[model samples]
Target: MGRMGLFRDAPQGVAAVASSILACIVLGTLLERFGPGNVHSGLPTFGAIWVVTAAASCAPWNYALTRFFICRTGATFVTLDANQFTCSLMVVLNVIGTATAEATEWGNLGHGVTQILSILVLSEITIHSGMAADTAWRVSLIVPAVFCLVTATGLKLLRRNTSTAARLDVSVTGKITKSLLWDSFEVLKDFRVVVRIMLYSTSIRTELAMNNQLTTRFRTYFLMDAADVSVLAGSFGLLNLVPYLCVHYVDVLCPGHLG
Candidate 1:
């Protein structure tokens, strides 16, 4: 999408993310409060909530945003080349200017920073505020939700006086077809594509498994209490965040060089 188009659609996108986050948080809180289970099971409950929210809300919203809005803006802007490396590079460089491979790295760095912030905030809440781990984690989620909400509100206000022509038009030109699913399956025809997908999926699953067991591992191996574990986790997060910050600053200072 053009910068203006992206700007106009920002509110809806932010609102969708905010709503999904809030929904997951609320559902998790309710489950923990009323469900009869060990407190440790709270992690699974939150994970399940996240999966459902992502599938039901976030996925569809993102698809629509990419398809109807971004695709409609221009096909050149879409990074759908067959060369995986080129496509990956274009995704990041395209964000700043036209070029093409460091977008994936930038995206990872952004996610890592957010994750670090979340871990640190939750650790602080658990240790200093003396809140339960379950409660502190849920409370930490409020930060992102509020940030998204505020961003959505700001975008909405900014667009309040925009002309109709400048506003985002989400209407599709014709009836949608089921061919999208069939087209998506066409990717499986390429062995490389299938292998790449499998590798990516495996990596994601591994990450999720490690995240789920992270706290238990720290407690078991280090003989740490909740507070100590939190501190340790936050320390790890800070260490991770520092490199990301440096890389991000370099990328901002010299755009496309990383690509």
Candidate 2:
């Protein structure tokens, strides 16, 4: 996309990403803070339960929102095949890869910046606010919730102002068919797809497990207090911005090759 196209698409992508980061941070922090203490030298049973429950609860809502709302919005702005009642996973990824690639990159850059801000906020609340850790964590949770509300409001305003010249007035009028479900499974028949799924799932699980244990590991192994841990996490967030910076330069040098 050109500079104008990137600017036009950026708000939606950044808003979506910001909302996701806020949700993950709140849920992850809750699991770390309030889940039962470890009984053994691994992930606590209750923490695992919390993670599982969160995932389960989110899955249905995610499916509904993607199928009913997001896809409908996309279809309004872009033509879809007549037989395609809803966007498949590949279609969604293709939209992200092409139309919103630069905007998504900016969104990721925003995520790293937000992470650092959140860490600093957490530190300020827990370390300098003269509040108990229990109370401070709860207070810190409010920050993300407020940010989410602001993002939602901004999105609403953006929607109101968005031009409808190319809009198709599309609505999701079809039910989820058995054929659709089977078509989704068809992707699993490919060996490469299966292997990719396994690798992605394993990496995600490992990342979550490590994140759940990060504070405990720092406290136990390094004798770091909450303040020190926050500082370290903030440092990681700062380091995370480096890749996004590199991405901008790479895109500048190679243009359309980024996606």
Candidate 3:
């Protein structure tokens, strides 16, 4: 990112990342609770199939999908660039929620196993035409969750790989703060790095926020019943796997790209 102004000291950059991650976590949790929508939509449903599928989506998004989205959206933030890396914290927090969906539902012990693809969403779609009300709500909750998780993860990996290729002009040669200071701070001395970093950061937050809410709001507020939500969610989870297949071979063309 041009923010480093020659990669200034990594101190500022790291601090920025730590701060952003913490903010995203706190905000995401609050947003998850009081933001709006049904209880499951706003909160993690440990027993909810929708939540589990969404959780799986986290692996891709948290790992590589970030790069694909950034470039596709013209955020083209460079991989490993200190300034923009902070923003990745947003992706991570999202993943954290998705990953924890199973835990949220475990019934009693606070732990549960998530399925590979959700069964709930498909059931909702099946019932969409016949069973209304409760079934519909179910679908709305689960299906959209599936879609959200899949979309987020897919986008993260896509953007990360693309940015790694675009590599910014600055080098990450600065030392990370070692002793006290705090874990979150990193420095960016470069001007160009600062500008470019800001350029990318400017677009991502809103983009993520909107998409995160759309599936749930659109459903709970508008479309089908809860059952319908679940079915829709499972469908997304089922389809999300198709992208991972691409990942297996992605490196064939671009060695180390998946890494």
Worst 10 residues of 3 by lDDT: 107-116
TM-scores vs. true structure, each candidate: 0.40, 0.43, 0.27
lDDT by residue for model 2 (183-259), tens: 44566689996786586357433433333345445655788765567556444434434453455355445645754
Candidate number achieving the greatest TM-score relative to the actual structure: 2
Per-residue lDDT for 105-142 in model 3, tens only?
Answer: 22111100112123344444555667553344334455
Residue 68 lDDT, candidate 3, scale 0-100: 26
Error of 1 at 49 (Å): 10
State the lDDT of candidate 1 residue by residue for 118-205, as single tens digits.
5667778788999875456556656654554454344344422112333312133142433233444565799997796687447433
What order do you get sorting by TM-score, best first? 2, 1, 3
Clash count for candidate 2 is 0
What local lDDT score does residue 99 receive in model 2, on the 0 to 100 scale? 27
In candidate 1, position 121 carries an lDDT of 73
Query: Between the candidate structures 2 and 3, which one is better when assessed by TM-score?
Result: 2
Summed backbone clashes in each candidate are: 2, 0, 85
